[model samples]
Target chain A: AQSVTQPDIHITVSEGASLELRCNYSYGATPYLFWYVQSPGQGLQLLLKYFSGDTLVQGIKGFEAEFKRSQSSFNLRKPSVHWSDAAEYFCAVGKGNQGGKLIFGQGTELSVKP
Target chain B: DTAVSQTPKYLVTQMGNDKSIKCEQNLGHDTMYWYKQDSKKFLKIMFSYNNKELIINETVPNRFSPKSPDKAHLNLHINSLELGDSAVYFCASMGAGRGEQYFGPGTRLTVT
Candidate 1:
Protein backbone atom coordinates (compact mmCIF):
# COMPACT_ATOMS: atom_id res chain seq x y z
CA ALA A 1 0.00 0.00 0.00
CA GLN A 2 1.08 3.57 -0.60
CA SER A 3 1.94 5.57 2.47
CA VAL A 4 3.46 8.89 3.52
CA THR A 5 5.68 9.51 6.49
CA GLN A 6 6.61 12.72 8.26
CA PRO A 7 9.37 11.81 10.66
CA ASP A 8 9.28 14.95 12.77
CA ILE A 9 6.24 15.10 15.00
CA HIS A 10 6.94 18.61 16.30
CA ILE A 11 9.60 21.16 15.52
CA THR A 12 10.44 24.57 16.95
CA VAL A 13 12.44 27.30 15.30
CA SER A 14 13.17 30.94 15.89
CA GLU A 15 11.07 33.49 14.08
CA GLY A 16 13.83 34.52 11.68
CA ALA A 17 15.44 31.08 11.28
CA SER A 18 15.16 28.80 8.31
CA LEU A 19 12.80 25.82 8.31
CA GLU A 20 12.85 22.38 6.74
CA LEU A 21 10.12 19.75 7.16
CA ARG A 22 10.99 16.24 6.10
CA CYS A 23 8.66 13.90 4.23
CA ASN A 24 9.00 10.46 2.70
CA TYR A 25 6.58 8.46 0.62
CA SER A 26 6.29 4.85 -0.55
CA TYR A 27 4.73 4.23 -3.92
CA GLY A 28 5.45 1.95 -6.84
CA ALA A 29 5.40 4.50 -9.62
CA THR A 30 6.36 8.15 -9.84
CA PRO A 31 3.81 9.80 -7.60
CA TYR A 32 2.23 13.20 -7.35
CA LEU A 33 3.53 14.89 -4.21
CA PHE A 34 2.00 17.80 -2.27
CA TRP A 35 2.58 19.87 0.81
CA TYR A 36 -0.18 21.52 2.85
CA VAL A 37 -0.30 23.67 5.96
CA GLN A 38 -3.16 23.91 8.44
CA SER A 39 -3.49 26.51 11.12
CA PRO A 40 -5.31 25.86 14.36
CA GLY A 41 -9.05 25.53 13.78
CA GLN A 42 -8.59 26.19 10.09
CA GLY A 43 -8.69 24.23 6.87
CA LEU A 44 -5.59 23.12 5.00
CA GLN A 45 -3.90 25.35 2.44
CA LEU A 46 -1.88 23.95 -0.40
CA LEU A 47 1.76 25.01 -0.12
CA LEU A 48 3.20 23.27 -3.18
CA LYS A 49 3.04 20.20 -5.40
CA TYR A 50 5.33 18.13 -7.63
CA PHE A 51 3.74 16.29 -10.50
CA SER A 52 5.92 15.89 -13.54
CA GLY A 53 8.94 18.02 -14.32
CA ASP A 54 10.45 20.51 -11.97
CA THR A 55 11.87 18.92 -8.85
CA LEU A 56 11.82 22.24 -7.02
CA VAL A 57 8.30 23.70 -6.84
CA GLN A 58 7.28 27.00 -5.25
CA GLY A 59 3.96 27.60 -3.66
CA ILE A 60 1.90 30.21 -1.86
CA LYS A 61 3.17 32.20 1.10
CA GLY A 62 6.79 31.87 0.01
CA PHE A 63 6.94 28.10 0.49
CA GLU A 64 8.96 25.73 -1.66
CA ALA A 65 9.38 21.96 -1.85
CA GLU A 66 11.89 19.78 -3.59
CA PHE A 67 10.95 16.33 -4.82
CA LYS A 68 13.74 13.76 -4.82
CA ARG A 69 12.92 10.56 -6.64
CA SER A 70 15.92 8.63 -5.41
CA GLN A 71 14.98 9.03 -1.78
CA SER A 72 11.22 9.01 -2.37
CA SER A 73 11.09 12.29 -0.48
CA PHE A 74 9.53 15.73 -0.81
CA ASN A 75 10.82 18.21 1.70
CA LEU A 76 9.32 21.64 2.40
CA ARG A 77 11.59 24.56 3.14
CA LYS A 78 11.50 28.29 3.81
CA PRO A 79 14.37 30.76 3.84
CA SER A 80 13.01 32.69 6.81
CA VAL A 81 10.26 31.61 9.16
CA HIS A 82 7.68 34.08 10.38
CA TRP A 83 5.67 33.84 13.57
CA SER A 84 2.56 33.34 11.48
CA ASP A 85 4.19 30.35 9.83
CA ALA A 86 3.52 28.20 12.87
CA ALA A 87 1.15 25.49 11.71
CA GLU A 88 0.80 21.77 11.08
CA TYR A 89 2.31 20.59 7.83
CA PHE A 90 1.24 17.49 5.95
CA CYS A 91 2.79 15.65 3.05
CA ALA A 92 0.60 13.68 0.69
CA VAL A 93 1.03 11.27 -2.21
CA GLY A 94 -1.32 10.56 -5.07
CA LYS A 95 -1.23 8.04 -7.89
CA GLY A 96 -0.87 9.28 -11.41
CA ASN A 97 -4.35 8.25 -12.64
CA GLN A 98 -6.09 8.32 -9.27
CA GLY A 99 -8.65 11.10 -9.11
CA GLY A 100 -8.15 13.25 -6.06
CA LYS A 101 -7.38 10.32 -3.77
CA LEU A 102 -4.48 11.27 -1.53
CA ILE A 103 -2.65 9.45 1.21
CA PHE A 104 -1.54 11.99 3.81
CA GLY A 105 1.20 11.86 6.39
CA GLN A 106 0.60 12.10 10.12
CA GLY A 107 1.52 15.83 10.09
CA THR A 108 4.26 17.84 11.73
CA GLU A 109 3.45 20.67 14.12
CA LEU A 110 5.69 23.71 13.88
CA SER A 111 6.09 26.13 16.75
CA VAL A 112 7.87 29.41 16.07
CA LYS A 113 9.65 31.06 18.96
CA PRO A 114 10.06 34.77 19.22
CA ASP B 1 -15.30 33.89 -3.01
CA THR B 2 -14.93 30.49 -1.41
CA ALA B 3 -13.77 27.83 -3.83
CA VAL B 4 -15.07 24.99 -1.68
CA SER B 5 -17.50 25.44 1.22
CA GLN B 6 -18.97 23.16 3.91
CA THR B 7 -21.96 23.78 6.11
CA PRO B 8 -22.11 23.64 9.94
CA LYS B 9 -18.61 24.70 10.83
CA TYR B 10 -19.08 23.05 14.22
CA LEU B 11 -21.50 20.30 15.21
CA VAL B 12 -22.13 18.84 18.65
CA THR B 13 -24.46 15.88 18.65
CA GLN B 14 -25.47 13.01 20.85
CA MET B 15 -24.52 9.46 20.02
CA GLY B 16 -26.98 7.41 17.92
CA ASN B 17 -28.24 10.57 16.24
CA ASP B 18 -28.09 11.01 12.50
CA LYS B 19 -26.58 14.06 10.88
CA SER B 20 -25.51 15.28 7.52
CA ILE B 21 -22.80 17.63 6.29
CA LYS B 22 -23.16 19.42 3.00
CA CYS B 23 -20.40 20.48 0.62
CA GLU B 24 -20.33 22.56 -2.55
CA GLN B 25 -17.64 23.84 -4.83
CA ASN B 26 -17.77 26.81 -7.16
CA LEU B 27 -14.61 25.96 -9.04
CA GLY B 28 -16.52 23.78 -11.50
CA HIS B 29 -14.41 20.79 -10.64
CA ASP B 30 -15.68 17.36 -11.59
CA THR B 31 -14.22 15.55 -8.59
CA MET B 32 -15.04 15.98 -4.90
CA TYR B 33 -13.80 14.22 -1.77
CA TRP B 34 -14.33 13.84 1.97
CA TYR B 35 -11.54 13.48 4.51
CA LYS B 36 -11.59 12.86 8.23
CA GLN B 37 -9.06 14.24 10.63
CA ASP B 38 -8.78 12.53 13.98
CA SER B 39 -8.07 14.16 17.31
CA LYS B 40 -4.39 13.42 16.73
CA LYS B 41 -4.63 15.32 13.43
CA PHE B 42 -4.15 12.31 11.22
CA LEU B 43 -5.91 12.87 7.90
CA LYS B 44 -7.47 10.09 5.85
CA ILE B 45 -9.58 10.01 2.73
CA MET B 46 -13.09 8.66 3.22
CA PHE B 47 -14.91 8.99 -0.05
CA SER B 48 -14.55 10.49 -3.50
CA TYR B 49 -16.99 11.27 -6.29
CA ASN B 50 -16.32 12.17 -9.89
CA ASN B 51 -19.05 13.54 -12.11
CA LYS B 52 -21.59 12.59 -9.45
CA GLU B 53 -20.38 9.00 -9.55
CA LEU B 54 -18.73 7.23 -6.70
CA ILE B 55 -15.11 6.66 -7.62
CA ILE B 56 -13.38 5.76 -4.37
CA ASN B 57 -14.75 4.61 -1.05
CA GLU B 58 -12.40 3.70 1.71
CA THR B 59 -12.98 1.37 4.66
CA VAL B 60 -15.60 3.62 6.20
CA PRO B 61 -18.55 2.14 8.03
CA ASN B 62 -21.78 1.50 6.20
CA ARG B 63 -23.57 3.89 8.54
CA PHE B 64 -21.85 6.66 6.62
CA SER B 65 -23.35 7.35 3.23
CA PRO B 66 -22.41 9.97 0.67
CA LYS B 67 -24.78 11.62 -1.75
CA SER B 68 -23.84 13.71 -4.69
CA PRO B 69 -26.89 15.45 -6.01
CA ASP B 70 -24.90 17.07 -8.77
CA LYS B 71 -21.39 17.43 -9.96
CA ALA B 72 -20.86 20.49 -7.78
CA HIS B 73 -22.42 19.21 -4.55
CA LEU B 74 -21.57 16.27 -2.28
CA ASN B 75 -23.19 15.53 1.05
CA LEU B 76 -22.23 13.05 3.76
CA HIS B 77 -24.87 11.51 5.96
CA ILE B 78 -23.93 9.59 9.06
CA ASN B 79 -26.26 7.32 10.95
CA SER B 80 -25.89 6.12 14.53
CA LEU B 81 -23.08 8.51 15.23
CA GLU B 82 -20.71 7.06 17.78
CA LEU B 83 -18.27 8.68 20.14
CA GLY B 84 -15.47 7.42 17.98
CA ASP B 85 -16.89 9.49 15.14
CA SER B 86 -15.89 12.74 16.76
CA ALA B 87 -13.46 14.36 14.40
CA VAL B 88 -13.05 17.18 11.91
CA TYR B 89 -14.45 16.46 8.47
CA PHE B 90 -13.14 18.30 5.44
CA CYS B 91 -14.51 18.68 1.95
CA ALA B 92 -12.33 19.15 -1.10
CA SER B 93 -12.61 19.46 -4.86
CA MET B 94 -10.26 18.97 -7.77
CA GLY B 95 -10.19 19.41 -11.50
CA ALA B 96 -10.61 16.52 -13.92
CA GLY B 97 -7.02 15.37 -14.20
CA ARG B 98 -5.30 17.59 -11.66
CA GLY B 99 -4.27 16.06 -8.39
CA GLU B 100 -4.27 19.38 -6.60
CA GLN B 101 -7.33 19.86 -4.41
CA TYR B 102 -9.02 22.91 -2.88
CA PHE B 103 -10.18 22.32 0.67
CA GLY B 104 -13.05 23.93 2.55
CA PRO B 105 -13.11 25.08 6.12
CA GLY B 106 -13.64 21.80 7.99
CA THR B 107 -16.67 20.87 10.06
CA ARG B 108 -15.68 19.84 13.55
CA LEU B 109 -18.05 17.10 14.73
CA THR B 110 -18.20 16.33 18.41
CA VAL B 111 -20.34 13.34 19.36
CA THR B 112 -21.15 13.51 23.00
Candidate 2:
Protein backbone atom coordinates (compact mmCIF):
# COMPACT_ATOMS: atom_id res chain seq x y z
CA ALA A 1 0.00 0.00 0.00
CA GLN A 2 1.18 3.52 -0.79
CA SER A 3 0.87 6.34 1.71
CA VAL A 4 2.29 9.72 2.70
CA THR A 5 3.38 10.91 6.10
CA GLN A 6 3.69 14.51 7.16
CA PRO A 7 5.31 14.39 10.58
CA ASP A 8 4.13 17.75 11.83
CA ILE A 9 0.47 18.36 12.44
CA HIS A 10 0.90 22.04 13.20
CA ILE A 11 3.86 24.39 12.98
CA THR A 12 4.30 28.02 13.96
CA VAL A 13 6.99 30.33 12.58
CA SER A 14 7.73 34.01 12.80
CA GLU A 15 6.89 36.13 9.79
CA GLY A 16 10.40 36.63 8.47
CA ALA A 17 11.81 33.35 9.68
CA SER A 18 12.56 30.33 7.57
CA LEU A 19 10.22 27.35 7.56
CA GLU A 20 10.46 23.68 6.76
CA LEU A 21 7.70 21.05 6.53
CA ARG A 22 8.75 17.44 6.51
CA CYS A 23 7.17 14.70 4.40
CA ASN A 24 7.94 11.05 3.86
CA TYR A 25 6.44 8.40 1.60
CA SER A 26 6.24 4.64 1.34
CA TYR A 27 6.58 3.32 -2.16
CA GLY A 28 8.36 0.49 -3.89
CA ALA A 29 9.71 2.52 -6.78
CA THR A 30 10.51 6.09 -7.60
CA PRO A 31 7.34 8.09 -6.97
CA TYR A 32 6.17 11.44 -8.24
CA LEU A 33 5.88 13.86 -5.39
CA PHE A 34 3.96 17.10 -4.99
CA TRP A 35 3.20 19.84 -2.48
CA TYR A 36 -0.09 21.64 -2.32
CA VAL A 37 -1.29 24.57 -0.23
CA GLN A 38 -4.81 25.38 0.86
CA SER A 39 -6.20 28.49 2.41
CA PRO A 40 -9.08 28.56 4.88
CA GLY A 41 -12.26 27.43 3.15
CA GLN A 42 -10.51 27.26 -0.21
CA GLY A 43 -9.41 24.46 -2.49
CA LEU A 44 -5.82 23.30 -2.78
CA GLN A 45 -3.26 25.05 -4.91
CA LEU A 46 -0.30 23.27 -6.40
CA LEU A 47 2.92 24.61 -4.90
CA LEU A 48 5.40 22.35 -6.68
CA LYS A 49 6.01 18.89 -8.05
CA TYR A 50 8.93 16.55 -8.61
CA PHE A 51 8.57 13.87 -11.26
CA SER A 52 12.14 13.10 -12.20
CA GLY A 53 15.51 14.56 -13.18
CA ASP A 54 15.95 17.47 -10.78
CA THR A 55 16.04 16.74 -7.10
CA LEU A 56 15.16 20.31 -6.16
CA VAL A 57 12.20 22.16 -7.65
CA GLN A 58 10.97 25.72 -7.20
CA GLY A 59 7.31 26.62 -7.05
CA ILE A 60 4.98 29.55 -6.95
CA LYS A 61 4.72 32.00 -4.06
CA GLY A 62 8.42 31.50 -3.34
CA PHE A 63 8.03 27.88 -2.29
CA GLU A 64 10.47 25.07 -3.04
CA ALA A 65 10.76 21.35 -2.40
CA GLU A 66 13.59 18.85 -2.51
CA PHE A 67 13.03 15.23 -3.35
CA LYS A 68 15.40 12.91 -1.56
CA ARG A 69 15.22 9.47 -3.10
CA SER A 70 17.42 7.89 -0.46
CA GLN A 71 15.10 8.94 2.34
CA SER A 72 11.84 8.68 0.38
CA SER A 73 11.04 12.24 1.34
CA PHE A 74 10.09 15.47 -0.36
CA ASN A 75 10.26 18.36 2.05
CA LEU A 76 8.81 21.82 1.50
CA ARG A 77 10.71 24.93 2.48
CA LYS A 78 10.57 28.71 2.36
CA PRO A 79 13.36 31.14 3.11
CA SER A 80 11.13 33.78 4.68
CA VAL A 81 7.63 33.11 5.90
CA HIS A 82 4.93 35.65 5.25
CA TRP A 83 1.70 36.36 7.11
CA SER A 84 -0.30 35.02 4.17
CA ASP A 85 1.70 31.82 4.24
CA ALA A 86 -0.31 30.66 7.23
CA ALA A 87 -2.29 27.84 5.72
CA GLU A 88 -2.49 24.08 5.43
CA TYR A 89 0.11 22.18 3.40
CA PHE A 90 -0.30 18.70 1.99
CA CYS A 91 2.25 16.30 0.55
CA ALA A 92 1.15 13.76 -2.01
CA VAL A 93 2.63 10.88 -3.96
CA GLY A 94 1.59 9.45 -7.28
CA LYS A 95 2.91 6.74 -9.53
CA GLY A 96 5.05 7.74 -12.47
CA ASN A 97 2.67 6.24 -15.03
CA GLN A 98 -0.25 8.00 -16.56
CA GLY A 99 -3.61 8.11 -14.79
CA GLY A 100 -2.22 7.45 -11.35
CA LYS A 101 -4.30 8.40 -8.34
CA LEU A 102 -2.78 10.70 -5.77
CA ILE A 103 -2.26 9.49 -2.21
CA PHE A 104 -2.13 12.50 0.11
CA GLY A 105 -0.62 12.97 3.52
CA GLN A 106 -2.35 14.35 6.55
CA GLY A 107 -1.87 18.07 6.06
CA THR A 108 0.29 20.36 8.18
CA GLU A 109 -1.32 23.56 9.37
CA LEU A 110 1.07 26.54 9.34
CA SER A 111 0.64 29.42 11.74
CA VAL A 112 2.72 32.51 11.16
CA LYS A 113 3.35 34.70 14.13
CA PRO A 114 3.90 38.42 13.93
CA ASP B 1 -9.45 32.44 -15.91
CA THR B 2 -9.98 29.63 -13.46
CA ALA B 3 -8.50 26.35 -14.64
CA VAL B 4 -10.99 24.30 -12.71
CA SER B 5 -14.18 25.32 -10.89
CA GLN B 6 -16.87 23.63 -8.83
CA THR B 7 -20.36 24.94 -8.21
CA PRO B 8 -22.04 25.60 -4.83
CA LYS B 9 -19.06 26.50 -2.72
CA TYR B 10 -21.09 25.60 0.38
CA LEU B 11 -23.86 23.05 0.84
CA VAL B 12 -25.89 22.24 3.92
CA THR B 13 -28.44 19.48 3.75
CA GLN B 14 -30.29 17.01 5.91
CA MET B 15 -29.37 13.39 6.19
CA GLY B 16 -30.75 10.90 3.65
CA ASN B 17 -31.06 13.61 1.04
CA ASP B 18 -29.61 13.44 -2.44
CA LYS B 19 -27.42 16.14 -3.90
CA SER B 20 -25.03 16.68 -6.76
CA ILE B 21 -21.84 18.69 -7.12
CA LYS B 22 -20.84 19.80 -10.59
CA CYS B 23 -17.31 20.43 -11.83
CA GLU B 24 -15.96 21.97 -14.98
CA GLN B 25 -12.49 22.64 -16.25
CA ASN B 26 -11.56 25.03 -18.99
CA LEU B 27 -7.97 23.95 -19.28
CA GLY B 28 -8.66 21.32 -21.92
CA HIS B 29 -7.14 18.67 -19.77
CA ASP B 30 -7.80 15.02 -20.47
CA THR B 31 -8.34 13.99 -16.89
CA MET B 32 -10.39 15.15 -13.94
CA TYR B 33 -10.77 13.93 -10.37
CA TRP B 34 -12.90 14.23 -7.26
CA TYR B 35 -11.41 14.26 -3.80
CA LYS B 36 -12.97 14.29 -0.37
CA GLN B 37 -11.44 16.03 2.61
CA ASP B 38 -12.75 14.64 5.86
CA SER B 39 -13.11 16.49 9.14
CA LYS B 40 -9.65 15.36 10.10
CA LYS B 41 -8.35 17.08 6.97
CA PHE B 42 -7.35 13.89 5.21
CA LEU B 43 -7.70 14.37 1.49
CA LYS B 44 -8.55 11.20 -0.37
CA ILE B 45 -9.25 10.42 -3.95
CA MET B 46 -12.76 9.27 -4.67
CA PHE B 47 -12.87 9.12 -8.43
CA SER B 48 -10.76 9.86 -11.48
CA TYR B 49 -11.97 10.22 -15.04
CA ASN B 50 -9.84 10.28 -18.15
CA ASN B 51 -11.30 11.15 -21.53
CA LYS B 52 -14.78 10.54 -20.10
CA GLU B 53 -13.84 7.09 -18.86
CA LEU B 54 -13.54 5.94 -15.28
CA ILE B 55 -9.87 5.42 -14.62
CA ILE B 56 -9.63 5.36 -10.85
CA ASN B 57 -12.37 4.61 -8.36
CA GLU B 58 -11.21 4.49 -4.81
CA THR B 59 -13.14 2.27 -2.43
CA VAL B 60 -15.91 4.81 -2.06
CA PRO B 61 -19.43 3.80 -1.08
CA ASN B 62 -21.83 2.85 -3.83
CA ARG B 63 -24.06 5.70 -2.79
CA PHE B 64 -21.57 8.02 -4.39
CA SER B 65 -21.48 8.20 -8.19
CA PRO B 66 -19.37 10.21 -10.59
CA LYS B 67 -20.55 11.20 -14.02
CA SER B 68 -18.37 12.69 -16.69
CA PRO B 69 -20.21 14.32 -19.53
CA ASP B 70 -16.98 14.93 -21.39
CA LYS B 71 -13.31 15.24 -20.79
CA ALA B 72 -13.82 18.67 -19.33
CA HIS B 73 -16.60 17.98 -16.84
CA LEU B 74 -16.96 15.52 -13.99
CA ASN B 75 -19.91 15.62 -11.63
CA LEU B 76 -20.36 13.76 -8.37
CA HIS B 77 -23.76 12.65 -7.10
CA ILE B 78 -24.37 11.36 -3.62
CA ASN B 79 -27.52 9.57 -2.66
CA SER B 80 -28.86 8.92 0.80
CA LEU B 81 -26.15 11.03 2.34
CA GLU B 82 -25.19 10.25 5.90
CA LEU B 83 -23.76 12.35 8.69
CA GLY B 84 -20.33 11.01 7.88
CA ASP B 85 -20.67 12.58 4.46
CA SER B 86 -20.01 16.00 5.87
CA ALA B 87 -16.75 17.19 4.38
CA VAL B 88 -15.23 19.44 1.79
CA TYR B 89 -15.23 18.16 -1.79
CA PHE B 90 -12.68 19.28 -4.33
CA CYS B 91 -12.48 18.94 -8.11
CA ALA B 92 -9.14 18.84 -9.85
CA SER B 93 -7.84 18.40 -13.39
CA MET B 94 -4.57 17.66 -15.09
CA GLY B 95 -3.11 16.53 -18.33
CA ALA B 96 -3.31 12.80 -18.73
CA GLY B 97 -0.62 10.90 -16.84
CA ARG B 98 0.75 14.05 -15.19
CA GLY B 99 1.59 14.68 -11.59
CA GLU B 100 0.59 18.33 -11.47
CA GLN B 101 -3.09 18.68 -10.62
CA TYR B 102 -4.95 21.99 -10.54
CA PHE B 103 -7.61 22.04 -7.84
CA GLY B 104 -10.75 24.04 -7.70
CA PRO B 105 -12.11 25.90 -4.68
CA GLY B 106 -13.71 23.19 -2.62
CA THR B 107 -17.38 22.82 -1.80
CA ARG B 108 -17.98 22.44 1.90
CA LEU B 109 -20.84 20.00 2.47
CA THR B 110 -22.46 19.81 5.87
CA VAL B 111 -24.92 16.99 6.44
CA THR B 112 -27.04 17.71 9.46
**CAPRI class assigned to model 2:** high
Q: How would you encode candidate 1's per-residue C-alpha lDDT over B1-112 as one tens digit per residue?
A: 9999999999999999999999999999999999999999999999999999999999999999999999999999999999999999999999987889989999999999
Over 4 Å off, model 1 = none
A1-74 per-residue lDDT for model 1 (tens digits)? 79999999999999999999999999989889999999999999999999989899999988999999999999
What are the candidates' individual DockQ scores?
Answer: 0.83, 0.81
In angstroms, what RMSD does candidate 2 have relative to the true structure? 1.0
lDDT of 1 at B110: 98
Best TM-score among the predictions, by candidate number: 1
Q: Which stretches of candidate 2 lie over 4 Å from their true place?
A: A96-98
Error of 1 at A35 (Å): 0.2
* Deviation (Å) of B77 in candidate 2: 0.7
